[model samples]
Target: MNTGVVTGGWSYVWAAYSLTAGALFLYGVSLFVRVRRIVQ
Candidate 1:
């Protein structure tokens, strides 16, 4: 099987997935920081 054909040229799909993951990670970190500050 050809590697190019295997990927199916869907670059945007991976980018969107990465963007979503980064956003979620940032949000979780922000929430954790806020909770810690409140506890202190």
Candidate 2:
């Protein structure tokens, strides 16, 4: 018998953190590339 229990609070927090980190990284890289292109 397997009980399916889907519930958590930390999982939500982890997801938010991952999303924020990904967005920040992408934004930073895009900004850096744009600046480099503008300088060239």
| lDDT of candidates 1 onward, in order | 0.89, 0.94
- List TM-score per model, in order: 0.66, 0.67
Count of residue pairs whose backbone atoms collide, per candidate? 0, 0
Ten-residue stretch with the least lDDT total in model 1: 1-10
Residue-level lDDT of model 2, residues 12-40, one tens digit each, is: 99999999999999999999999999999
Error of 2 at 1 (Å): 34
Which residues of candidate 1, in runs, are more than 4 Å off?
Answer: 1-7
